[model samples]
Target: MTRYEFVARAHAEGYSPPKEVTFAPSTRSEPHTHDQLSFVYVVAGTFILNTDRAAPAYQPGETCLLDANVAHAEEAGPQGATILVARKSGRVAETG
Candidate 1:
Protein backbone atom coordinates (compact mmCIF):
# COMPACT_ATOMS: atom_id res chain seq x y z
CA MET A 1 0.00 0.00 0.00
CA THR A 2 1.03 3.60 -0.42
CA ARG A 3 2.38 5.57 2.54
CA TYR A 4 -0.81 7.55 2.79
CA GLU A 5 -2.93 4.44 2.99
CA PHE A 6 -0.57 2.87 5.48
CA VAL A 7 -0.66 5.85 7.79
CA ALA A 8 -4.41 6.17 7.51
CA ARG A 9 -4.92 2.52 8.33
CA ALA A 10 -2.52 2.63 11.21
CA HIS A 11 -4.20 5.64 12.70
CA ALA A 12 -7.60 4.06 12.30
CA GLU A 13 -6.26 1.05 14.13
CA GLY A 14 -5.15 3.24 17.03
CA TYR A 15 -1.45 3.51 16.34
CA SER A 16 0.43 6.62 17.30
CA PRO A 17 1.88 8.92 14.66
CA PRO A 18 4.72 7.34 12.72
CA LYS A 19 8.37 8.16 13.14
CA GLU A 20 11.08 7.55 10.56
CA VAL A 21 13.92 5.13 11.16
CA THR A 22 16.88 4.50 8.92
CA PHE A 23 18.85 1.30 8.83
CA ALA A 24 22.38 1.13 7.48
CA PRO A 25 23.33 -1.08 4.56
CA SER A 26 23.52 -4.79 5.41
CA THR A 27 22.66 -4.16 9.00
CA ARG A 28 21.02 -6.82 11.13
CA SER A 29 19.34 -6.60 14.49
CA GLU A 30 19.39 -9.17 17.23
CA PRO A 31 16.08 -10.85 18.02
CA HIS A 32 13.95 -8.51 20.08
CA THR A 33 10.50 -7.70 21.29
CA HIS A 34 8.46 -4.55 21.63
CA ASP A 35 6.01 -3.82 24.36
CA GLN A 36 3.54 -2.23 21.97
CA LEU A 37 1.85 -3.32 18.80
CA SER A 38 4.16 -2.27 15.99
CA PHE A 39 3.43 -1.04 12.51
CA VAL A 40 6.14 -0.56 9.94
CA TYR A 41 6.04 0.94 6.47
CA VAL A 42 9.04 0.77 4.20
CA VAL A 43 9.84 4.10 2.64
CA ALA A 44 13.02 3.23 0.72
CA GLY A 45 15.31 0.36 -0.13
CA THR A 46 14.46 -3.00 1.41
CA PHE A 47 13.60 -4.35 4.82
CA ILE A 48 13.76 -8.04 5.65
CA LEU A 49 11.59 -8.89 8.61
CA ASN A 50 12.56 -12.08 10.37
CA THR A 51 10.30 -14.04 12.64
CA ASP A 52 10.47 -17.63 13.82
CA ARG A 53 8.09 -18.65 11.07
CA ALA A 54 9.33 -16.52 8.18
CA ALA A 55 11.47 -13.78 6.80
CA PRO A 56 9.72 -11.54 4.32
CA ALA A 57 11.26 -8.81 2.24
CA TYR A 58 9.39 -5.51 2.15
CA GLN A 59 9.89 -2.94 -0.57
CA PRO A 60 8.94 0.71 -0.69
CA GLY A 61 5.25 1.36 0.04
CA GLU A 62 4.91 -2.02 1.74
CA THR A 63 3.90 -2.38 5.33
CA CYS A 64 3.96 -4.95 8.15
CA LEU A 65 2.20 -5.31 11.47
CA LEU A 66 3.65 -7.03 14.49
CA ASP A 67 1.77 -7.98 17.61
CA ALA A 68 2.89 -6.80 20.99
CA ASN A 69 5.98 -8.56 22.36
CA VAL A 70 6.38 -10.89 19.41
CA ALA A 71 9.94 -11.98 18.93
CA HIS A 72 11.49 -10.78 15.69
CA ALA A 73 14.59 -9.43 14.06
CA GLU A 74 15.38 -7.15 11.14
CA GLU A 75 17.89 -6.97 8.33
CA ALA A 76 18.54 -4.15 5.93
CA GLY A 77 19.13 -4.83 2.25
CA PRO A 78 22.43 -3.88 0.64
CA GLN A 79 21.40 -0.35 -0.26
CA GLY A 80 20.01 0.25 3.24
CA ALA A 81 16.44 1.09 4.20
CA THR A 82 14.26 3.85 5.59
CA ILE A 83 10.97 3.07 7.28
CA LEU A 84 8.15 4.72 9.16
CA VAL A 85 7.05 3.06 12.36
CA ALA A 86 3.95 3.60 14.46
CA ARG A 87 3.00 1.86 17.66
CA LYS A 88 0.01 1.31 19.92
CA SER A 89 0.58 0.82 23.58
CA GLY A 90 -1.30 -1.86 25.50
CA ARG A 91 -0.78 -4.97 27.54
CA VAL A 92 -0.66 -8.21 25.62
CA ALA A 93 -1.74 -11.39 27.29
CA GLU A 94 0.79 -14.17 27.67
CA THR A 95 0.21 -17.34 25.70
CA GLY A 96 1.50 -20.81 26.34
Candidate 2:
Protein backbone atom coordinates (compact mmCIF):
# COMPACT_ATOMS: atom_id res chain seq x y z
CA MET A 1 0.00 0.00 0.00
CA THR A 2 1.15 3.51 -0.68
CA ARG A 3 1.48 5.90 2.23
CA TYR A 4 -0.70 8.96 2.06
CA GLU A 5 0.31 12.51 2.72
CA PHE A 6 -1.78 15.61 3.25
CA VAL A 7 -0.69 19.03 2.17
CA ALA A 8 -2.61 21.94 3.63
CA ARG A 9 -2.47 25.20 1.80
CA ALA A 10 -4.35 28.48 2.03
CA HIS A 11 -3.79 28.99 -1.70
CA ALA A 12 -2.53 26.71 -4.44
CA GLU A 13 -2.08 27.03 -8.17
CA GLY A 14 -3.93 30.35 -8.32
CA TYR A 15 -6.65 29.15 -5.94
CA SER A 16 -7.12 32.44 -4.10
CA PRO A 17 -9.40 33.73 -1.35
CA PRO A 18 -10.63 30.18 -0.88
CA LYS A 19 -7.72 27.74 -0.85
CA GLU A 20 -7.13 24.10 -1.53
CA VAL A 21 -6.54 21.72 1.40
CA THR A 22 -5.07 18.43 0.27
CA PHE A 23 -5.68 15.28 2.29
CA ALA A 24 -4.06 11.86 2.61
CA PRO A 25 -5.27 8.31 2.99
CA SER A 26 -8.21 7.89 5.36
CA THR A 27 -8.13 11.56 6.21
CA ARG A 28 -11.10 12.86 8.12
CA SER A 29 -12.83 16.02 9.17
CA GLU A 30 -14.91 16.53 12.27
CA PRO A 31 -18.50 17.39 11.71
CA HIS A 32 -18.07 21.05 10.93
CA THR A 33 -19.19 24.00 8.93
CA HIS A 34 -17.60 26.82 7.01
CA ASP A 35 -18.24 30.55 6.91
CA GLN A 36 -17.53 31.30 3.30
CA LEU A 37 -18.54 29.34 0.24
CA SER A 38 -16.33 26.27 0.08
CA PHE A 39 -15.79 23.10 -1.88
CA VAL A 40 -13.26 20.38 -2.67
CA TYR A 41 -11.61 18.70 -5.58
CA VAL A 42 -10.73 15.07 -5.03
CA VAL A 43 -7.27 14.76 -6.47
CA ALA A 44 -6.80 11.05 -5.98
CA GLY A 45 -8.19 7.97 -4.18
CA THR A 46 -11.75 7.37 -3.00
CA PHE A 47 -13.56 8.93 -0.07
CA ILE A 48 -16.86 9.20 1.70
CA LEU A 49 -18.33 12.56 2.60
CA ASN A 50 -21.45 13.18 4.62
CA THR A 51 -23.39 16.32 5.36
CA ASP A 52 -26.80 17.24 6.66
CA ARG A 53 -28.06 17.23 3.10
CA ALA A 54 -26.07 14.47 1.44
CA ALA A 55 -23.59 11.64 1.68
CA PRO A 56 -21.57 11.39 -1.43
CA ALA A 57 -18.89 9.08 -2.83
CA TYR A 58 -16.01 10.89 -4.42
CA GLN A 59 -13.31 9.78 -6.80
CA PRO A 60 -10.35 11.49 -8.33
CA GLY A 61 -11.15 14.95 -9.66
CA GLU A 62 -14.58 15.11 -8.03
CA THR A 63 -15.85 18.38 -6.59
CA CYS A 64 -17.93 19.14 -3.49
CA LEU A 65 -19.47 22.30 -2.13
CA LEU A 66 -21.26 23.33 1.02
CA ASP A 67 -22.91 26.39 2.48
CA ALA A 68 -22.00 27.81 5.86
CA ASN A 69 -23.37 26.34 9.11
CA VAL A 70 -24.05 22.99 7.50
CA ALA A 71 -22.66 20.07 9.44
CA HIS A 72 -20.34 17.88 7.40
CA ALA A 73 -17.97 14.97 7.84
CA GLU A 74 -15.56 12.85 5.80
CA GLU A 75 -13.39 9.72 5.74
CA ALA A 76 -11.18 8.40 3.03
CA GLY A 77 -10.34 4.90 1.79
CA PRO A 78 -7.80 2.45 3.18
CA GLN A 79 -5.32 3.73 0.68
CA GLY A 80 -6.40 7.20 1.69
CA ALA A 81 -7.82 9.98 -0.41
CA THR A 82 -6.49 13.26 -1.64
CA ILE A 83 -8.83 16.21 -1.23
CA LEU A 84 -8.35 19.75 -2.32
CA VAL A 85 -10.64 21.85 -0.14
CA ALA A 86 -11.40 25.50 -0.71
CA ARG A 87 -13.18 27.75 1.74
CA LYS A 88 -13.38 31.22 3.20
CA SER A 89 -11.35 32.42 6.10
CA GLY A 90 -11.80 34.95 8.98
CA ARG A 91 -15.45 34.83 10.19
CA VAL A 92 -18.17 32.25 10.44
CA ALA A 93 -20.97 33.12 8.07
CA GLU A 94 -24.12 31.45 6.65
CA THR A 95 -26.37 28.77 8.17
CA GLY A 96 -27.36 25.14 7.66
Candidate 3:
Protein backbone atom coordinates (compact mmCIF):
# COMPACT_ATOMS: atom_id res chain seq x y z
CA MET A 1 0.00 0.00 0.00
CA THR A 2 2.99 2.27 0.42
CA ARG A 3 4.73 2.57 -2.89
CA TYR A 4 5.99 6.10 -2.34
CA GLU A 5 7.35 8.15 0.52
CA PHE A 6 5.75 11.25 1.94
CA VAL A 7 8.07 14.16 2.33
CA ALA A 8 5.46 16.38 3.86
CA ARG A 9 1.84 16.29 5.02
CA ALA A 10 -0.42 18.94 6.43
CA HIS A 11 -4.03 19.90 6.86
CA ALA A 12 -5.74 23.25 6.57
CA GLU A 13 -8.94 24.48 8.08
CA GLY A 14 -11.94 23.45 5.97
CA TYR A 15 -9.72 22.01 3.31
CA SER A 16 -8.57 18.60 2.24
CA PRO A 17 -5.23 17.40 3.58
CA PRO A 18 -2.21 17.77 1.34
CA LYS A 19 0.84 15.57 0.99
CA GLU A 20 4.09 15.71 -0.86
CA VAL A 21 5.13 12.32 -2.20
CA THR A 22 8.29 11.30 -3.92
CA PHE A 23 8.80 8.32 -6.20
CA ALA A 24 12.14 6.89 -7.17
CA PRO A 25 13.22 6.62 -10.75
CA SER A 26 11.50 3.82 -12.68
CA THR A 27 9.20 3.16 -9.76
CA ARG A 28 5.74 1.89 -10.52
CA SER A 29 2.63 1.54 -8.45
CA GLU A 30 0.32 -1.43 -8.52
CA PRO A 31 -3.22 -0.95 -9.73
CA HIS A 32 -5.20 0.60 -6.97
CA THR A 33 -8.35 2.49 -6.05
CA HIS A 34 -8.89 5.39 -3.68
CA ASP A 35 -11.89 5.88 -1.48
CA GLN A 36 -11.56 9.65 -1.74
CA LEU A 37 -11.14 11.88 -4.74
CA SER A 38 -7.55 12.68 -5.63
CA PHE A 39 -6.01 15.88 -6.90
CA VAL A 40 -2.41 15.56 -7.97
CA TYR A 41 -0.01 18.30 -8.98
CA VAL A 42 3.30 17.41 -10.47
CA VAL A 43 6.14 19.36 -8.94
CA ALA A 44 9.22 17.86 -10.53
CA GLY A 45 10.24 15.19 -13.00
CA THR A 46 7.74 13.23 -15.09
CA PHE A 47 4.99 10.74 -14.42
CA ILE A 48 2.95 8.34 -16.51
CA LEU A 49 -0.59 7.65 -15.45
CA ASN A 50 -2.79 4.86 -16.72
CA THR A 51 -6.44 4.75 -15.92
CA ASP A 52 -9.59 3.13 -17.19
CA ARG A 53 -10.13 6.16 -19.41
CA ALA A 54 -6.68 6.91 -20.71
CA ALA A 55 -2.95 6.57 -20.40
CA PRO A 56 -1.28 9.93 -20.28
CA ALA A 57 2.14 11.27 -19.46
CA TYR A 58 2.48 14.30 -17.21
CA GLN A 59 5.30 16.75 -16.70
CA PRO A 60 6.19 19.21 -14.04
CA GLY A 61 3.44 21.77 -13.27
CA GLU A 62 0.82 19.45 -14.79
CA THR A 63 -2.13 18.36 -12.74
CA CYS A 64 -4.50 15.41 -12.66
CA LEU A 65 -7.83 14.93 -10.99
CA LEU A 66 -9.11 11.45 -10.34
CA ASP A 67 -12.51 10.54 -9.06
CA ALA A 68 -13.01 8.24 -6.15
CA ASN A 69 -12.82 4.51 -6.85
CA VAL A 70 -11.28 5.00 -10.26
CA ALA A 71 -8.85 2.19 -10.84
CA HIS A 72 -5.46 3.38 -12.01
CA ALA A 73 -1.73 2.91 -11.95
CA GLU A 74 1.31 5.18 -11.96
CA GLU A 75 4.93 5.03 -13.02
CA ALA A 76 7.75 7.43 -12.30
CA GLY A 77 9.88 8.82 -15.06
CA PRO A 78 13.54 8.04 -15.49
CA GLN A 79 14.45 10.95 -13.24
CA GLY A 80 11.85 10.19 -10.62
CA ALA A 81 9.01 12.50 -9.52
CA THR A 82 7.74 14.64 -6.71
CA ILE A 83 4.07 15.51 -6.52
CA LEU A 84 1.65 17.33 -4.29
CA VAL A 85 -1.54 15.42 -3.69
CA ALA A 86 -4.70 16.31 -1.89
CA ARG A 87 -7.19 13.70 -0.88
CA LYS A 88 -10.70 15.04 -0.51
CA SER A 89 -12.47 13.11 2.17
CA GLY A 90 -15.64 11.93 0.50
CA ARG A 91 -17.03 8.87 -1.22
CA VAL A 92 -18.36 10.78 -4.26
CA ALA A 93 -20.01 7.74 -5.80
CA GLU A 94 -20.34 7.80 -9.52
CA THR A 95 -23.77 8.55 -10.93
CA GLY A 96 -25.00 7.29 -14.22
Give the best candidate by lDDT: 1
Each model's TM-score, in the order given? 0.87, 0.61, 0.75
As for TM-score, the candidate ahead, 2 or 3, is: 3
Kindly give the number of clashing pairs for every candidate. 0, 3, 0
Residue pairs clashing in model 2 are 21-85, 25-80, 26-80
lDDT of the candidates, in the order given: 0.90, 0.62, 0.73
Best by TM-score: 1
Model 3 TM-score, all chains together = 0.75
lDDT, ranked from best to worst:
1, 3, 2
Across residues 1-96, which tens digit of lDDT does each residue of candidate 3 receive?
A: 121322132243222656788999989899999887776778888988889789888888677777888899888999998887878755445456
Over 37-81, each residue of candidate 2 has an lDDT whose tens digit, in order, gives 555667777878888767888887556656656778887877777
Query: Which regions of candidate 1 deviate over 4 angstroms?
Result: 90-96
lDDT of 1 at 86: 94
Model 2 TM-score, all chains together: 0.61
| Candidate 3 Cα outliers beyond 4 Å, as residue runs | 1-15, 90-96
The candidate 2 region of ten consecutive residues with least summed lDDT is 1-10
